[model samples]
Target: MNLKESEPTASASLSRRKFIAGTGLLLAGATLKLQANPLVSGAPLSTLFAEPIIDIHQHTDYMGRTTDQLIAHQRAMGITKTILLPSGRPVNSASTHFGVGNGLQAKATGNTICYGLAKKYPKEFLFGANEVPDVPEAIEEIERYLKLGACVIGESKFGVECDSPEMQKIYELAQAYNVPVLMHWQYGMYNYGLERFHKMLEKYPKVNFIGHSQTWWANIDKNHLDQKVLYPKTKVTPGGLTDQLLSNYENIYGDFGAGSGLGSMTRDEDHARIFIEKHQDKLLFGSDCTDITGHIDNCLGAKIIAEVRKLSPTKKIERKILYHNAKKLFRL
Candidate 1:
């Protein structure tokens, strides 16, 4: 699930019927060849209306990218704005890089980087502060980012469940500041399952938490599931826990960012349609992709967008997922 540089591999074996069922392309107008719409029209009246796209989740480090280069890559992919978090604290104090801090939390200086990006690309970037909850300064760091105008607080990759008490405290702060919290909800393959996600939504109604990666995608089932053993490699049929979460909760949202995350949801047409139709508003488009080459090609974005276009739903609900919902949620 840490897929920092991996390609899509999970659903590569899906058959054509399964693809149709998973993505819903078979139910739509036609296999509309996916293309970048410079001037989009014929959009659904019910979908959220906003400009183009604003990718609310991403990470950027100085592997080989400059600020200008980052912005240019995003623009090419139709991203009007982006939210970035530092990779982590530096391992060596003598190193100029911001230390990777404790395994998952951002250092105080992380807020500085976010604030700086917001200042530089006021129109094209927004700040989301990342902090590890167990860190001594976690509470103070959240307050600092809020004061400095961070619109959101995390794509917090916890090695635990979302409903843990430590996370509850962070959710409390997010609720207080009216900022969204983006967290990685991946638990191998249904590690925490749907019940955990539902509990989080029930307990933290005021806090908006964006779900990402495999665990969230794997849970969307509406009926009795047909068990197929993909044996030691264990793969469940789509649409079990994920569908339930989307249909039941308004505050809970999905961030389709990781490669496995994207592949699981979009590999089949029926699965894609069910996901799009049932949770269009709840799904937020993102790539979880970084690095200079990936940015330039916007590879992840292009691939997922093509998958959505292939579905060709009666409505272009994708616009809302890819852009407007994020704009409204982050107030970007």
Candidate 2:
């Protein structure tokens, strides 16, 4: 979560840790401090690795941001290539509430905007297509972008059941095109039904699935209550459903995007270290951040990259998540 334009906020009495843990939002406007990078001969991450880091998640025309703002934000965060996910349909503010666990709302951007950005800046941007599953024009609109050479087909962030027939149609298109599908798996909110998603996984073996959102990250805990507890700060017990899904399914992957992702890693550093090593091959780096500053103090995306850089067992594995895996998955 934590996209949208609203600044990070919490109750007056809450501490930074509690605020971030509770809201699952990034700690915006904090002071900047550079972390050491062992892989690049101790260079700061912002200035080094200028060619390989790929941001697998981002948006086009997010919060009314201009093209310059978007490009500057990515470049400053050390993102060499960005996967721009445009929204499928307009969101209903009444249904998609601004709760602590849910993502903030923004006006939907069409597939053509993403297509234009990726086309104009081929090296720096890659575009995706999306549409509300239940809408009659869903498959046809999505297929139009796919035919126009869209790399992926989602941020399938609509309020639909995970296994809805319309959603399956999107998966079928993904299978036909042989392209990866990125889904925002917010429990009870976006892409409903996390526990039973394995059926789709089994049914569509050829389509690569990338999972994101608070629910996806919270399920890193085996004991995660099957409800609205989005950012659980408890010590992680191994073999959680998320871990199991990543381990058991070759086509499934995790996106370390947004504050919920950072929260999962921060909840228990020890668990994060072990989890990184175990699923190094399946994890993908994606920062579903909305800030434009691009500084580590303000950018949630850069912070996720920093966490991966600090925790990966090896630089090779780090590079795989940061760039190579997406390159192979998206054929970039």
lDDT of each: 0.61, 0.80
Give the number of the best model, judged by TM-score.
2
Query: What tens-digit string does per-residue lDDT give for candidate 1 at 104-198?
Result: 33222355776787887676677777565655567787777788788887766545445666677888899999988776554532113345667
TM-score each candidate: 0.70, 0.81
lDDT tens digits, residue span 261-300, model 2: 9998989989999999898878888877778878889889
Provide the global lDDT of candidate 2 against the true structure. Answer: 0.80
Candidate 1's C-alpha runs over 4 A off are 1-51, 62-66, 86-109, 188-194, 221-238, 291-298
